[model samples]
Target: MAEERTESKTTILIVDDSEINRDVLKEIFKDDYTILEADNGKAAIDMVVKSRAFLAAILLDINMPEMDGFAVLTEIGKVKLLDKIPVIMITSDTSAETERRCYEQGVADVICKPFEPLIVKQKVSRSIELILSKRHLEEQITSQTKLLRAQYQQLQKQQEILKKNNALIVEKICTIVEFRNLESGYHLRRIHDFVSILGRYIMNMYPEYGLTQYQVDVMADASAMHDIGKITVPDTILLKPGRLTRDEFEVMKSHTTRGCDIIRMLSDIQDKDYFEYSYDICRHHHEKYDGNGYPDGLKGEDISIAAQLTGLADVYDALISERVYKAAYSMDKAFGMIVNGECGVFNPKLINCFRQAKLEMNNAFLKTKMKEKEELKALHGEDDDYDDD
Candidate 1:
């Protein structure tokens, strides 16, 4: 009475080579479920594909004339559309290798022949639940994939507009920040170059970090504004000839927070990856993993990864190159200091990555410098030629 109550609740497809076996099972499970019968694996697959109702579970017999269940499984596996359905292999073989192979082939369960009606009932119940779960997950992935592809297409269409606006926004901020030491704030250019270098390394090493060629370009473009908050600080503090007074230093430290906030207020940063990049450059750039840094004083992994990495790039550029108040150090000097753990300013993880991609990063730095020179010349109306050069 209970079995009849149960099979009535689920859709079951039973495959067997023997007509007698099919009759016996049908009689046993008749009251419990809506049962569909097939004489072999081929018929079971055909029934599954054509049925309007979704399959709750499949009982596949391994031994049969014409097509064995194993062969049917191989064919079923090849059909991508039907891959989510769970198949319970019904066979008397009981060998360890056979059992292992069934699991490796994605079979949900194995049932020995001369099966007790109760065991059949129990296995079917479990496998049906599993199959339904698998189908639900597959449906979720399919829906998500569709959503992603649509979003990607929309983004591609708006990409050119995004790039132009983003550039203009960053340029304005850059101009504001560097107006005092504008002659030397070329460090802004180098910082973008450094971000691209690290971005490429992260892409090659861990593509899962949301790194892409487009993202690299975006990082290079957005990184220009990392120091934009400095514009809000007083000229007295920014252009001071020596170390900042503690009060002045506090005001200076506010730049990181200020930069992030400024970027946040812009509509352009509302798009994809903007907040991620901004969050990194803004909040945690001054944080130390060991908890001794500035702004948030965040330590360890609590630091936003984007901020931590940008911190490393920012410090390296500061250490290696000329500033309004300092001369350029040789690459060897800067690199040695970086590797030796200078103060607590940098993320060691990023420093290690710098070593691995050192040659590439330096090359990118030179390219960025050249690009900056070109921009400067263009701004001054320096080049005139064959109307094209």
Candidate 2:
């Protein structure tokens, strides 16, 4: 009963030219609603415009003086109040055309006169119930939409943090390898650039490879880990200035598999795609296309594309850079050696991409070399002006 009285605070507007008809409706709804009265359509429109937010329903009469109910409905619609407040036509006109007009004007229902008070009350009550229910559902949907957007934003932030952590781990590992190999820090940078140049050329020139720019970038970054296993090799074998004996060479070859082991231990911390690319490049970068290289002689396309791309880049960098056992070959000689298969058999498709990327790769290496020289000069306190050549 208390709840019922609380709900009765809702307003109902009664519009009719006849005082008796308005009185009848006011009596029927008086117990359950706060009623407002207007004896004509113009007066009703003025009240509705002022009190639309407080109204639950409107009872309107069709045959009225000065203005008809239809004109009032049109005015109410222009202000967009019909949807928010239910309106039921209360009229003596029982003609089908009059009823149709009331409906077309967006009245909730038509109650014919002399009307049954119970039926009029029931129809108006149902319309108000439906409108209230719809509003409640709209509110719920809006709240849920906001929650989902917030959750998606949180997920994106977490993913970015994970990516940064993974990059930091890679950097630390590369730094360790640089110090152990007695190679300049720029060696890793050159390898990264070489892999990128070849990978992008392959992606653009051969649609069959199905490589996206994102995948190519991942492959280039993973190339840094290709020789990470060399960290496990003994300094006697790794830093030897003469040719390796057969037994020492076998131990050196083990670095490929050992590098994969190191990457596997980090699986928990690495992104799935990055881990897979790193593992493949570490384990199979030495495998030749003709199945004649070590440690696992994976042949042809059996080798992962990431490994193949990194393998080519690694060999190119190794040939052009001085190592413990050999002098650095000139760029022209190194390019010829790979094309002629003097080093090992390589994929014809990759060789073609290599040829296409040669100029860009050369430029990238020289750029890195110049940068390293400038840094060394700066460290030695040399003047800024230096020869471009």
Candidate 3:
């Protein structure tokens, strides 16, 4: 059974012009591998081309009839078969020149004419082992590459789904503040737009601030949550038609610190940079640049740029929009109040950004108002258009 199995194994093609040399090589490998014989180089090439897939190696004589070993090497090199199957040269001339020429023709090993059976067997075994190992490694690399590609595609799909869910959560939170009636329906929307306008201007004019377009967008999104803590304030003070007493005003001011607390509770669900932006804007948007504002009297650049931008936007929106305690001011009056330090002292740099962004901020406010009117008309059949007071 063992002999039968070896006879059915992959072939070793032995090519030589002498019958005696071909018979010698065949006797050596006859037990371990199936042996195929060719008396001339042309016959060897034909056998190799027909049975290349099943051939393990080719042992060729340098001096042969019709087509020499060099000619056979040249023909096989065209097909790139040498990369997969090694060719060992057998020669009577063992000079340094002949050996160099044999290796240059892509020969794996050179052997003298009076062949040593042990060395021949060992060299053939080693060459076949090396080829098999290389083939296995190539197959593994191809398989791993395909698997990594599939995993990368799967990760991208997961990230997209996560992004949509986060947007929905933000909308729902903003809806809660709207339901409480602390601000007008368009108040948060206006703030988001104003912050975006100012943020872009500041980023362009002051490269030292290290603000990117992405950070600007994050600050704009976070501005909506600046007043989220007002939900904790009582409706009596929040909706009071008259100015609050000193004690009630203090309670109203606590909304900033309280808003930060609320955001901390939600830290686990928010992205790292977004959570930081939200937390800073919420707690410090009410802070004054002159160390006189509420909660934490943070002054100047000590107040984060995100907080500063949101604070300016919040004051502008409050001035132009009708609230329970105050009627809406004109656009010109709102811009003047902020820049002149009437609402509260602000950073000089930010005031410059605010001044430069005046026309854009006005347009944004009007655009939002128009959109709100259109939405109201769609929902309640009200077609009355309102102007900036």
Which residue pairs show backbone clashes in model 2?
none
Q: Write the per-residue lDDT of candidate 3 for residues 59-128, one digit (tens) a residue.
A: 9998998999989999889989887888899999989999999999888888788989999999888888
lDDT of 2 by residue, 1-389 (tens): 95455345988899999988988888999888988899998999989987787789999888898899888899999998888888999888889999998888888888988869899889999999988988888889999999999999998898778678767877888789868863635687788899889989999999899999989988888888888898999999989999999999999999999999999999999888889999989999999999997887789999988898888888888899888789999999999999999989999999999999999999998898888777667755666566433
* Deviation (Å) of 55 in candidate 2: 4.9
lDDT of 1 by residue, 286-344 (tens): 88878998787888878865666677778777776656457667766877777777746
Clashing pairs in 3: none
TM-scores for candidates 1 onward, in order: 0.56, 0.68, 0.62
Between candidates 1 and 3, which one is better according to TM-score? 3
Model 1, runs deviating above 4 Å: 1-152, 183-185, 206-218, 267-269, 343-345, 371-389
Better of 1 and 2 by TM-score: 2
Which structure among the candidates has the greatest lDDT? 2
Query: What CA RMSD would candidate 1 show?
Result: 9.0
Q: Local distance difference test, per candidate?
A: 0.74, 0.87, 0.86
lDDT of 3 at 47: 88
